[model samples]
Target: MAEETHVLDRPPEGANADWTIPQHWDRYTAEEHATWDTLFARQAKLLPGRASNAWLKGLDVLKLDKPGIPDFEALSDRLMKLTGWQVVAVPGLVPDDVFFDHMANRRFVAGNFIRRPDQLDYLQEPDVFHDVFGHVPMLADPVFADYLAAYGRGGQRALGLDALQYLGRLYWYTVEFGLIAEPEGLRIYGAGIVSSFSESRFALEDPSPNRIAFDMARVMRTEYRIDDFQQNYFVIPSFEELLRQTVETDFAPLYAEMKARADIPVAEIVPGDTVLTHGTQDHARSRAAG
Candidate 1:
């Protein structure tokens, strides 16, 4: 989700009311397809042991291995059959309400463009690779699919309560940068981590960032960094539990409670946290000191 101020009053020219545009898959040049292939090849090599099983399986199920950027129609056809989810192209970021409404109904809106070859390591906005490669795989899992839909519904309600700040945190921590615990170990699932070459390693292997158990209340009150790697990562025990906590809880009171409390500092570990790793914050400090 984007900031409220970035939301335009209406859809820009050529976009639908929902801010969706045709993916225009045929229009992609050979160079753009090559860029997708390069990114895909690297991530494919790196993600097998590092990414969640569900995400890895989704990549196979979606047949993303074929050369060139995927045709959204083909991708959606497979995804819809498995999970009632379809990917739609958007000009770029959409308003929160539009985003929530689409996801609530299981339509995943993705940016239509891919990052340039030179910017492969980082890009300011989420491109098609981040949206499709990073996120769509997890959508193939039934439980994660339900959790996202639930989050979308929750986002709508949060808007009514003027609690989007709280709701957005849940999305940021879980959907974008979340980790999941498998019997083997903690694995990367969040799109932000899985899509990132650097962060995928840093999130699990590096000792500079904290890894903490997922707590809904604590997550809502905590701040996250968008300009750099997260100093903290929240790990869920399982998708089943994640969905259970999200669907069963009512957030109105939670939001009210959070409003009265101070926002948790990004790297601060509070008393009740189930700390998995007490990071040195060495990376953050060096970056700051640089």
Candidate 2:
């Protein structure tokens, strides 16, 4: 199983606050570029036909072909023309507020470093492999681009309403590890799954996790595990629909309602769930039994 890392809701220091403000773009070593290529080559081989059209299309449009670690300045120029979105380098996971603030303003953060080859299967903090390669291409999509920005705007509201947990679930199910139903079959769109080879396969083919419909309230109430493959994977009817429902809906009322309620456990199945595959909990139990 791939390991997980959960970032806090607030910045631990001033570092996360201004990561979007770029400086010193010419500092990468040749070894760093090699690292990006190594990771990129591995994921590329694994994702064909399994990843969404939007993801593949965006990858092509962005010209991820230049090789090595992408130069943010050069990459941002092309991305900015397409969606007004630009990737910024962060040291690691930023405070939740720092993350939200960046997203709210059309800025996408990526870890500035690449993962070591041995850590390729999993790492505690997001690296450039998990950031730029996993996330930037999707920002090129108009619908997903907007949905992310809206989620960022909703972040502060979630904090005030004490509904961050609720909103966080929406993020977990959608942005980080969500799936989309394509006419051909299920496709990968979430950054978390896309970046890792094992989870990419496990998320789609394994019977260990519940594949449920995306419900804003239900996702919020439900808890997620960062340490293992997710117990549940939310499936959207389509990437277009996923973006439409989330970006267009007003979350203020929803947050207010969730604030007074208790969170749902990862194991409970909710009603009205469009259950694609119900898990027996045997996969989860084996871990506990260990």
Candidate 3:
């Protein structure tokens, strides 16, 4: 999700009023397709045991194993059949309202461009790989699909309530960097964790970040880092419970309550939290100390 002020007032030239443009899948260069393949292969090899069952299932259901960057048209055809979701291309990040509107309608807006080979490990803005590969697989799951659409609808309401920050935190912590407690162990489901080769391991195996149970109020009051791996991860018991809590609760009051409270420090564990792994925070400290 993007902040309203961070994007242009109107769509860029060549984009439609809604900020969408044709994916033009044929235009991707061999080098670009190779970059996608490189990223895909590494993550595919690493994620089998670490990623959530739902995410792995979505990979098979969507046939994401195909070579090169996926054609949004073909990807959407399969996704639309499973969960009424379709992938749309955008110049880059769209206005917050446009994003929410698209999500609310089950249309996911992805970047049309792929990252440069030299910048494979990191990119300031989300590219096709992050937007599609990171996010779309989970969109295939029924419950997660509904949860995202609901988040989009809630985002619209959040704007009216002046609560987009809180709502965005919900997206960042869950959709971006969340973990799920599988029967076998804590598994990665968050797009941010699953998409990157390094973070897929760091988020699960590293003893440097806190893993806490999901709590709506605590999450909204907390802040997160965009520059590095998360110092904290919120784990949900199941997608069903995640959806039930998100859809069933009204957030207006929650937002109001959160606004009155101080923001939770990114790495601090508070009382009443159901602590899972109390991290050493070694990574965060090393980064800071360096």
Residue 239 of model 1 has an lDDT of 97
lDDT of 2: 0.80
Q: Which ten residues in a row have the lowest lDDT in candidate 2?
A: 1-10
| Candidate 1 colliding pairs | none
Compared with the true structure, all predictions reach lDDT values of 0.92, 0.80, 0.92
Query: Model 1 has how many clashing residue pairs?
Result: 0
Ranking by lDDT: 3, 1, 2
Clash pairs for candidate 3: none
lDDT of 2 by residue, 1-290 (tens): 01223354543344435644342446666766777788888899999878888888889999986787787888889999999998887766776777788899898988766666678788878877788888888999988998899889989667677767778889888888989888889999999999888999988988888988887678877899999888899888876687777777778877777767777788678767879889877779998898
Query: Which has the higher TM-score value, candidate number 2 or candidate number 3?
Result: 3
RMSD of each: 2.8, 3.5, 2.8
- In model 1, what lDDT does residue 69 have? 89
| TM, every model | 0.97, 0.90, 0.97
Residue 76 displacement (Å), model 3: 0.5
Runs with alpha carbons beyond 4 Å of true place in candidate 3: 1-9
Candidate 2, residue 42: CA error in Å?
1.5
